[model samples]
Target: MPPITNVERVYQERYAEAHAYLKATNSENPFMVIRAENKFIELLEEPHIPFWMRAQCNAILAGLTDETADARKYLKGAHTSLGYFVQIRELATGSLSDTAGHRLAQLREQLTKIERDIAAREAAKEQRSAQNLEDDKEMLLEGQRSAQDLEDAKQMLLGPEQEMLHEPVVTDDTRALPKTEPKPASAEQSLEQGTERMDIDSDRSTATLFPPHTEVTADSSQHAADSDTDMTSQFSDNESTATVKMEEDDDEVL
Candidate 1:
């Protein structure tokens, strides 16, 4: 005899229990049948069960159930299982039954819609990312421009200040020269003194050059006396004028 596999052993045990439950005809023991159905459903969930078989089991469960909600739930699970099994089988065998082919076409339509939605979302995301990058680039350029403007402004502001700092400064020590005290005799005073000296010398020379004849000597002496008096008066007038001018200067200064 062939060695009994784990799957076969499990199936045998489950079949025995289910057959026993079905064979019991006690009208008061409906719970036993329900328990058997639940057990069968548990077997369907096992990975060892073929997906197609599980789908068939779920469909039978849906038909046997009286509750509309439970029936729909079972049917939906059956449809999902059937779709998975058909996709896997078609990949391996490259062929499908009519029912599986129709189900696959419906799944393909759903897949196409999902793929389109995903592509649209990705495209929108990429567009947003590109827009954000462009915005960042613009912001960076703006910042650079602003920084450059600030630097230019700083240079403009500093230019005149630097020129002023470099320019030569004229302080009292640099500009002032040592002064000499002025002599008291101005050109006018010196000129008057020189004229007076010349006149006196000429008169003395004239007096020495010729002693006048005795009769004219008395008249010459009288004329010389009158000239001497005029000279004294002129000297006095010049002194008064100089004094007045000095007073005027002093008043202006005050």
Candidate 2:
């Protein structure tokens, strides 16, 4: 065979790269799968003038179509990828056509398995959500019942006197009355109060003259006698002071 031209070599390399992406879709990584699908589209967009190039393009298209069909089935849209698989299959030929047919068979098997797994997971999730909702509802009702029971117990435990404390005191005159200032004491009342106060002071002084709960011993009698002598001396000094003032007046008059 003659050495391949640069253009043919390039197409071969790109064809292999596209196939690698197609195989990557099996990994089930969403981002990697999306990138692989885009790569396939890019290769299909290239000019496939040569028969070999066109065959490679057809193979990539067939793979892409099957992958998209599987995804669409999960999304619940058109069960088919708009008849794209039929169109790509018609374009495939020889070894390329055989490869596409084998890949499609494998993809269909994988797609069926994936659908079952997805359905099972979704059913389990919905069941768990429903159970959690029921649990929360029961808890809320239990809390409300507990509160009601506590209130009933409170009513049973409280007597009439305790209940009366909680009740508002209602009266015929509910309106507030005008505030009245107090009157000042009259002169007669003031004089009587003063006299009463003086009498109280005199009684307090007399009580203080003798200590309470003491025996009348000779020492106590002597202490009383000493107090009387001190008072008499004070009176004599006052009288002497008045006599001095009177003598001075007489001298001024003379």
Candidate 3:
């Protein structure tokens, strides 16, 4: 049996109340021993018992602290203290069952593990956030560099184009390239040159290939006819002279 708490004194003081509560209930038919035993056990289960025990222990401890006593009072105080210790132990270990303690221990372990897991996850998330920030910084730098390069390229291109547009087309150096020249020949010029060449060729064509042209001479033809007439007259005169000589010779022969 557990040692008596200070409630033992209270129950001793109110023994009549316990007896009256027993008489009022069905517990009256039973022997007072059994009835009192059951009622006392029920009283142990009451909310007031723990507070009452604590107050009694504090009172005893206070009295012991105030008094410097010889051997008998000291022994009595020790006995009361021992009894109070036993009652507290019974309230703590006896009322709080083994199963309840086990359950509480499991809950404590689970709560601790959950807290540790949450902490680790938060740390990892913070690390990832830092890495993401670094990556974003690099990306921003790369974007700025690309934008700068593109701007420089655009400026260089526009400068050259402006210079080319304002520059002169012709140069004093013969080695310098000429600008876009005329691609087509004019039709009137081609036709005039062609007609001039055709006229010159016609004027000199067959005459130049053979001899020079000459005038026909009518006087030469008349002179040749007169010479033929003179030849005919001389032949007639010779024939007449020959006839006359033949006659003279005939007379001499006679």
**Number of the top lDDT candidate:** 1
Query: Relative to the true structure, how large is the alpha-carbon lDDT of every model?
Result: 0.70, 0.68, 0.60
* Candidate 1 lDDT by residue in tens digits, 74-121: 444655785688778979999988986886788656545534544565
Off by over 4 Å in 1: 1-88, 91-94, 170-254
Q: Evaluate model 1: give its lDDT.
A: 0.70
**lDDT (0-100) at residue 119 of candidate 1?**
53
> Which stretches of candidate 2 lie above 4 Å from their native place?
1-79, 82-100, 162-254
Report the number of the highest-TM-score candidate.
1
Worst 10 residues of 3 by lDDT: 27-36
Report the C-alpha lDDT of model 3 over 153-238, residue by residue, as the tens digit.
99998998999999977566865666788767699988998999999898778567654764347986788789998999999999
Compare candidates 1 and 2 on TM-score and give the better one.
1
- For each candidate, give its TM-score against the true structure: 0.32, 0.31, 0.25
lDDT of 2: 0.68
Error of 3 at 79 (Å): 40
- Looking at model 1, report the run of 10 residues with the lowest lDDT sum: 25-34
Clashing pairs in 1: none
Candidate 3: segments with Cα more than 4 A from true spot: 1-100, 160-254
